[model samples]
Target: MQNAGDWTRRLREIGIYAVIGAFLTIISPYNGSGNLPLWGAYLYWTGLVLTGSLSAEATRTLMERTGRKFGVPVMLALMSVTSALAVTAMIILLEALTSGRSIPPGYLPRLFGLVWVIAAAVTAVGIMIERTVLAPVTEPVKGASPEETFLSRLPVKYRTAELYAVSAEDHYLRIHTSHGEELILMRLADAMRELAGADGLQVHRSWWVAKSAVRDTRKQGSKLSLVLPSGKEAPVSRTFQAEVKAAGLSA
Candidate 1:
């Protein structure tokens, strides 16, 4: 499934570059040499796209190690540098392979132009690559858990999601899912670390819920209850009210 997605994204990206390259061809003083060289350039662009998809996993690993979120901007910057370096290596290798020619040493003008053009093409590809590979995981979040945010372990399947909320029998968390809630021997903070790509917020000391599951927000005196979309009311303390509001959790 991922391979198909990657290929589909790559094809779309190639079409975009093809259109741009066509415009450049029209603008440049073209005499001959059909699409051979252009196709070669296209191949190089594909390499950058693959680099981006490959980087997505590595960047997720980086986030795990640093305990930080791998946002879009950071991912783009990393891929830009990576693609640029890869293009440079390709150019050097190509030059070495064709080194038997007696070409003039003072080809500075064309060399500089070629370098920038290739770099620009690779950078364009890098951006697209980052988008496809990182979109699902790096998407903006409505809220973050206080103990440990879901952004820590990204691009990985959470063994159990339906049970993201609910408390264990005692001193532990119970993740309630369609498959049924599971008793996890951990703290609210510790257990919150296992959740991502779900809705809900930590209203009180022990509750985390899916925002979509929230049916209504009701207040009585100074307290609140997050009425789950399922009709279950989870208490919301004053201390966590600000967070609840920030999640845009409707009342």
Candidate 2:
């Protein structure tokens, strides 16, 4: 089932890029490339767009793995720069191979600028699609536990254990449960979607706690944290403190 979902997401992403590629082909932005035959132009833009998109995706994944949060605009800027560099290199190589000529050093910067524009546009579109089209449906399944979907991702021994909280550790998530704790390779953002049906709210950028698992609230100076059964504490960031209080977890 997980594999199926992954494939569906990949196909949708490819479709979105293909549409953008087609649009670029029609417009023919570059003066030299605009003179190419229709078929050749289509192939050129589509291939480049797909390659650039993949490069951007890889950059985004790498950034996420570093465990440092970035605002949307900053993230997009980083991805665009990385993708532009990769695509620019690809373009230079292809031109040299096909035309037996190297792009002049002075012209390389301009070529990168053009590629950056396309990369930024594609990155923005991909982010929008992820937030809208590919976001997980939060509705509960009929006749099933609210946490069923999320629990399914746990190891067999932990599947039936009551979920306590989840904390981010680099590119992995440390799952705390009634039985014990375990680690899984998944992003906190993606885990939140799977955990939507569970009775929990994100208490911090890196922590999500099940209301039932929060035994008490801990305060140190102006900071707040949620104490769980196993003596583990999940810090509640100022950003989410209001939500935690409103949910009665901070009481």
Mind giving the per-residue lDDT tens digits that candidate 1 earns over 42-141? 4444543444335444644565576443444464556454444554455455455555433244764454355455444555454444434433332233
RMSD of each: 13.2, 7.2
lDDT of 1: 0.51
- For model 2, the superposed segments whose C-alpha errors exceed 4 Å read 1-4, 137-144, 148-209, 213-215, 218-251
TM-score of each: 0.37, 0.63
Give the top-scoring candidate (lDDT).
2
> Model 2: what TM-score?
0.63
**On residues 67-93, what C-alpha lDDT tens digit does candidate 2 reach at each position?**
555666787899999988988888788
RMSD to native, candidate 2 = 7.2
- Per-model CA lDDT versus the true structure: 0.51, 0.80
